[model samples]
Target: MQSTKLVETRGLTKRYPGVLALNGVDFDLEAGEVHVLFGENGAGKSTLISMLAGANSPTEGTITLNGQALAFSSVADAQRAGIYTVFQEFSLIPTLTVAENIFLGWEPMRGPFVDHRAMRRRAHDMFEELDFPIDPTAITASLSRAQQQMVEITKAFHGDLSVLILDEPTASLTDREVDHLFGFIASLKERGVGIIYISHRIQEFQRIADRVTVLRDGARIGTVAMAETDEHALVEMMTGRAITEIYPQIAHTPGDVLATAEGLVTSGVSAASLEIRAGEVLGIAGLVGSGKSRLFRAMMGLAPRLGGKVTLKGQDVTRAPTRAILKAGMYYLSPDRKAEGLDLAKTSNDNLALNLVMGGTGVSRMGFINWKEVRAESARIADYVELHAGYRPKLVSQLSGGNQQKVLFGKCFGQEADIYVFDEPTVGVDMGTRSALYRLIQQLAEAGKAVVVISSDLPEVLNLSHRMLVLAHGRISAELSGDEMVEELVLKHFFDESGAKA
Candidate 1:
């Protein structure tokens, strides 16, 4: 391990038209050290890193490398300087193979031809070094999100890297995959590479961070050695207040059954049976590939169902398309907010007005469109969801992660459906927004709307749901209510032998 500063930022500031994304913040990363950049959503973490990575130019700041001032004109410039960042949203081309994507733009060439064999060999070597199992010839689009994330990381570290930035790298990973990622990071740290790790999961810091820096509302609170600070203290520093309990117990009174699945079989699940009751929240907990998401999609006919029966309010709605399912007053909230939940390139009104248009409420006469009326309804729902900056005309991409998620909720809330299905609703949401989302779910239940929340977050599912279901290997293994909904027991059923049994 080296005892030298690899990178430093002094008075770093980035400003948008109306928002000061990052203030004059000073930070540093030491060689061979894992420095965790801790902050809530919109706290300027992304802006700061983007500037450092040359994805965005700093409005006012100074970046130094080995005591020399560094001015990166573009991401390529940063890459030449051995600085790399793996952002949450991947940048891989869906049509390219994993090996091709890894060496994209800088592929080895023999005379006038690209050296495909050499590229595949190098990709295979990189995967072997990390003990990562991924087909080099597999198309990027065909890979799962977690596998795509691996491709991104492999691309970032393909050659030489003095500084590595990882933002929410584990959000898409399963527990075992996370272990592998951490082990690989450990090796990088031992090799004297400076790493800037960003994650909303507080529990992860203690495991990999050597030092932690807290940023709040664009200003740096302070940096503390990992051994000197605890997770509770770190949370307080990041939020500027103690998050007493993020998960609050809500007394939900479940009413008559609103939806039910009997002897259900889908592309990834089988023999599943459950009921969703109005005025209640049903929580589903499982590992990443355990078929929870598949079950929801199959219910809506988004996935192929081998055999199953799904009924909404005593009406058997089997083998129905997604449109029919939505027409039946049931809505699905996508776990991947950016990819499937909301269209980032479109205007806020356009995205927020999707459900209204889909439900035929955006039209006036003879299939004629009334964008004005749709905008009016959009404004109403945006206000109800407390949209960022109050329905301003901007692409959904301009909003922060939390606000983008809010816009997704707005788009879905416009449905006014009898039942709502949420998958990882709060996956990338920060503490404050997560609490607000919990309240929103509770409000839905109180208003007699049935909700099903499927999350990898155990405590969140336990606190938010009135009745909980655990799935393993595509089958419902345990149903726990009230006293049986503790985290430990739910986890046992989630990973235990019983969860995989039919």
Candidate 2:
């Protein structure tokens, strides 16, 4: 491992018309070191990385590489300069084979002829080097999110990447997959690759990062050695407050059955059905690709309902589309908040007012969007959710994860839905924001709304759920309620051999 500075940025600043996206930030990446960039959403981490990737040019400041100043005109230029970035969104084409995507532009050529065999061999070798078993000939669409991520990383590192940028690489990965990714990163570091790692999971940072840098509201807080600071102290510097409690439990009396499904079946599952009671939080837990998400989508009509009878408030409603199901007082929040919930390209006001405008409130007049009415209702929901800066007209991508979730909740709060289905609502948020979300969910139940929180986080499910269901291999393996809230019981019931048969 070399002790040379591979990349450095000084006085980096980027400003929009109304918001300063990145303040005069100073950052450096040493050769062969894994440096984690820690911050909340909209903490300017993405902007900084975007600039580094040559996706966006910095409004001010200078970037130096290996004691020489560098200017990249585009992402291609950045890659040519030996810097590669893997964003949260997989860059692989879903319809293309993994090998085709890996050698997309730089395929090996033999005497002016494309060498397909060489391409596949190199791609397979990359996977083998990383100890990943993904098939290079398989279509990218057939691969799971984790597999797709591996493909993306392989593509990024196929060539010489002196500095690699990974944004939330493990957010969608399972524990095993995360371990694999970390192991690959360690290998890359040993080979003298500097990595700029970004993640919301603070616990993992201490495990992998040699040094840590904190940014808040577009300004650099400070950079420190990982061994010198703890996650709590780092969070305090990032958010300016000590977060003691992440999840706060609230009590509520259960009410009547708000929703029920009979013989529900979708393409993703066989015979499946469930019921949700008013003021009840049903926690659903499962591994990735375990059909837990499918069940939620089927209930909300996001998936094709093969066979089912859904009833809301005693009204028989079956085989309805997403719009109809939502109209019938049911709503669903996606785990992918940025891609599915918020419109990163649009302003916060528009994203928060999406349901209101679509539902034809005063915001919609004769199929026309009334900007004034939309803005007014958005302001109300933003206040209710206590969003910072009271309805930021800025883009939704420019907000923190906790704050973005607040906007998502604000959008849904405007709709009068009797049942709310939340899928991984706290996936990438911090402890404080997660606690606030739990409080909000409790408030929703107290207001007589039946809530189904689908999450993989065991502690989150145990703390917030009144009743819990475990889905194993597209089937409800276990159901526990009332006094049966022990984590050990849930695990054994969900994974034990007899539990599978039972």
Candidate 3:
């Protein structure tokens, strides 16, 4: 493949307070190829891309395009220079139509007013060209993650994009949607569009990467052709260790049922029933909108149960509110760390002690709480989860995605809940952090704490769960235990059990 250099970075460096996000590193991208960037969370993968996409100005180094040095002051500057970035979190407005979101602030105008018809027509054309069926007039909030992703990608293509940067593009997409996205990317590559892809899922590299670059501790570890390196070698490069087994699910006998849901129904779920037992992980597997999350939320009374009962610790909590359910020694941890899980604006110590500080009996007669106790308790949980102590004082917003998640785990560790419900616990975390979280989960089960892990990653559920429950269209399609828990069988229920219903 003979291609000219489209973008290049020389001795790139980024410094933030005590952190060195990116070291003096040299990187380059050529036209018509997919170059994957791999690293653990906080490994500078995003930092490097932020520089390339002009989201951040580098404290040091130079950027070049077409053999000429270039500097970008803002995202608009990057877009004008033919660079666009699609972030993991969306930028679409919930109430606006798809076309409205596509154009955003720059609507197609006729003299002094906006031309809604022309904008919708253009959006429809872009969707057709990508072989996707996203309705331009559909509400942006009503579209599925895959459809929204199409809108985001189209927004980039709407511009004269010479280079595209996608961060965790397939994180929320189903397998079918993933195939569609891959094909779309292939077409972009054929058009001489240089794509910079970043993902924690190593399996994705095998599908789309031409060349893979590994970053460790803000420095380039190595760059290798995708055809030449295996997943093992890639993991070894990203983490300075040879991880023989990523999932070390220790075998243990499950104890008595700690929590039970009987005919539970929620907004997304029609009817679901299951039991969570001590010393075992009850795995929940389903596609997006399949009600796996709703089932858990309903179980904890987070969502109103229209009918049926949830017996937690032999006590009926069907009518009990979420606060009471948690008081009953059951806790629900949201997979979304930023919104529902932790306060990104607060210090890690505050986020860690959020629950205890409010719920505990440490308030003084003058209404002054015990600060030392909170700090000690927070530190202990952080140490157990392997989070850096230096990060305890930093705002959660400053920590990496993986560390912020650790803070969530730390909160649960302090509470010592009897039944722990984790939804997509390892979504964007790196391979090393994943292994650590896996161990922490196994340890919890071994300690006789009941666990339920709801995840889109089938491999994660199959490995950690003693029993698996596959949901489809708000119903339990199949329940597998012992030797019946395989990926093929579990996924079959995700489709066959759900059928084509809502």
What are the runs in model 3 whose C-alpha is more than 4 Å off? 16-18, 89-121, 131-148, 267-271, 364-368, 498-502
Which pairs of residues clash in candidate 1, taking residues 3 or more apart in a chain or in different chains? none
1-502, model 2: which lDDT tens digit per residue?
A: 4479999999999999989999999999999999999887778999999999999999999999898998889988898889999998777788989999999988899999989899999998988887888898999999988898888878776557899999988888877788888988899899999999998888688779999999988899999999998977887888787755555565657898878877777775656667798888889877665677898788778787788687878877776678887888889999888778888888777787777877776743456677788778878778777787644788887766778888888778767798999999888886557767888898888787888999877778888888988877677777788788888888775553322322
lDDT of 1 at 64: 96
lDDT of 3 by residue, 280-353 (tens): 88888988778899888888777779877799889888899988988888989898888799998999888878
For each candidate in the order shown, give its overall lDDT on alpha carbons: 0.85, 0.83, 0.86
After superposition, which runs of candidate 1 have C-alpha atoms over 4 Å from their true positions? Answer: 135-138, 157-159, 228-231, 362-371, 499-502
RMSD of each: 2.6, 4.2, 3.3
Local distance difference test, candidate 2: 0.83
Model 2 residue 214 distance off true place after TM-score fit, in angstroms: 2.5
Q: Count backbone overlaps in model 2.
A: 1
Provide TM-scores for the models: 0.91, 0.80, 0.88
Best by lDDT: 3
* Candidates ranked, most accurate by lDDT first: 3, 1, 2
